[model samples]
Target: MLQLREVNIDDKQTFDKYITKHNPQISELNFTNIFMWRNSYKFRFGEVGEMLCLISVPDNDEPFAFEPIGAYTKEAFIQAIDEISNYFKEKNWKLVFKRVEEDKLDYFKEYFKNGIDITDDRNNSDYLYLSEDLINLKGKKYHKKKNHLNSFTKNYEFEYVKLTDDLIDECIRINEEWCKKRSCEQHRNLYCERLANLEALTNFKKLKYEGALIKVNGKYEAFTVGELLNSDTAVIHIEKANDDIRGLYNAINQQFCENTWKNTVYINREQDLGIEGLRKAKLSYNPVKLVNKYTITCK
Candidate 1:
């Protein structure tokens, strides 16, 4: 039987070593995301054969695991499938895998023909943007973005500071204020997101994240957090701003990319979760591509 354990910041080094070898392209592959949402999603981890597996046991949903990490050959994945199947067999549920990247789909077909069903998971597909496109905001496509940034600059005396221990509390305060304004208590997803953001802020340094804070009139108004997803891509996990303020979103988005991730070729803002407003907002950025994701259900 595979021994599973709760995910923690202490597991970062081990996770990083395995992650680097595999270099997954999906947003969920990042360790920080796993650590922060550990509670909300009931995440657990273990090793089976040569594969590192992450399982999500949400309260209301049927439990599922992510596509296995590390060097997963077809044979190794089959072993992992067996291990997961035995663990969940008592539930009388099919073993399901989420966040299965496009390139990895063929590996599933190699082992399970009639047992597996792979389908597009558009809600979880990641949006990929050119880092240069976000930082430069050049051409007519970005006219509105530029205009918003300009208005923010003209109206407020603001400072963009690299996030540090001293500013974490301020960021938390601003996050609370933002949540209150949005009535997070009424929305379960937003409320859960607030908890995840708090965990990230509390363990920012331990998680090895790079962050930026925005101060308008010398008060914290916005902040963003991200990390290197792979050699060529940086993934943004959290970005919150005061929507009431006319261009704070555009300004922070531009400045954060310019200051922190200029070396990367692409930026992944993660998923929109099928929210109409969020989907529209992400689409407006004119992503260069969408990293298609899929769900694999084993019957």
Candidate 2:
């Protein structure tokens, strides 16, 4: 079994050394994603055959590995997964890989054949959009979205400001009210998401985040955080708005893209998690493609 260590804020530099070199598609490939949800997922990392290996052990579920980061060769990956499988066996848990990106799916199918089940995890797949489409909101497809942004612009005295550490208090205030309205206290997933939000904001600069916030009618109402996932795509880690104010969500999203991410070709808004309303909202923007993630389990 490979030795592993807990993921910490200080480990960002170590992880980014591997991640930045790889061309990652899914949102999970970034350190911020792992670091922010470290509480729920309990992520640990170590090197196997010189490739960075990651594993998640949730408090309520069986442990599983993610696709190894850094350079890939069939020999190195096979050895890494083999070691990971044995590590899980020692703990008496089945070998599993969750959120495996599409490009790496072939490796598992060809090398680890027997008793392996590979299924698409649609609920966790990322929604990718053309940065231009999101920023410009051009044509008939964006007619409704354009209207919403226009309404917010015309009605509210709003300022689109850079999300800095000084505004953390205002961000927290909006989040507290948003959590109550969404009934996050009664829902496990929502509660986990709330914690993720706090984790991102608290470590904003350390995580390499570039974010934006909307001040509507002299009050802080909405904000979003995101970072470059790879050479071409920027993934949004968090987005929150005061739902009581119509079009605030649209304003925050549009302003963030227009102001922060125009240099990137694609924007990864991330998954809907099988939430009906969330799915509808993401779909309304018309994603260019869906980056499908898969889960593989050895039976």
Candidate 3:
């Protein structure tokens, strides 16, 4: 039998255990975000013995529920969805599953059918397939990217290392400077709060064991952290670069893809969130394919 239970602060250990056992590399769904958003949201755990399904709902929202961050078999996924839909219906709520992954679209469509209204929000995530064989690239494409990388390497004597206590302070300093210049209140506030929460930051660092930090002239300029989605895939959770530099963004991006993800076959850069500049920047990379995310709203 399948049952849904609310996830509370006490369930942290269990949640982390589930993540560690099933998928250790995808750090985006770490306990930090779950705890950070816990008060503003509610988590429901669908369980059948050792298997589990997680669903989140924002405090102010009633019609929609965020996608489950954890893993589940297809059968368990459908069962959980059905049970959750019934629960929502009882409460007079129309459940909408947000950010449904492209690969699971068919499953959702087949199961939800006429009961749920499916909509493609037109947002897409770009993913790059890494190849250790540099010879696979076309002459023109290969030359262009190589030229850009070479230029950045020659211009900046930067170092990429694991984010440590000493270097994290530099990342905050650079990030603050960048935010101040742009007058980005939202990012600045969130960054400051995250920094102040030592435990959360520590947890993030722990989860991002393979994260990289880029320093130019011994000063932090950019940083990115991610986890492996699967044995062959790594997903970047956060990437921030010094906006003052000309090619720092491109350089770090290329470096991480080439150097950091050497063993992985694919890199999931996550979504663009419907931002024009973000969309354009992601599009310029010439992604191998776009991961289409959808939302299903019950009528």
In order of appearance, the predictions have TM-scores of 0.97, 0.97, 0.76
Model 2, runs deviating above 4 Å: none
**How would you encode candidate 1's per-residue C-alpha lDDT over 131-239 as one tens digit per residue?**
9999999999988888999999999999999999889998898889989998998998899999999999999778979999999997889999999999999999999
Question: What RMSD does model 3 have?
Answer: 4.4
What's model 2's TM-score?
0.97
- Collision pairs in model 2: none
lDDT (C-alpha, whole model) for all candidates:
0.89, 0.89, 0.61
Ranking by lDDT: 1, 2, 3
On a 0 to 1 TM-score scale, where does candidate 3 land against the true structure?
0.76
> What is the lDDT, from 0 to 100, of the residue 68 in candidate 3?
46
Model 2 per-residue lDDT at 29: 88
Compared with the true structure, what per-residue lDDT tens digits does model 3 show for residues 46-134?
55444446666655566455444446567756766766677677777667777666566676767766766768766544445454422
Off by over 4 Å in 3: 1-51, 59-63, 66-75, 124-126, 131-138, 142-145, 186-200
Q: Any idea how many clashes model 2 has?
A: 0
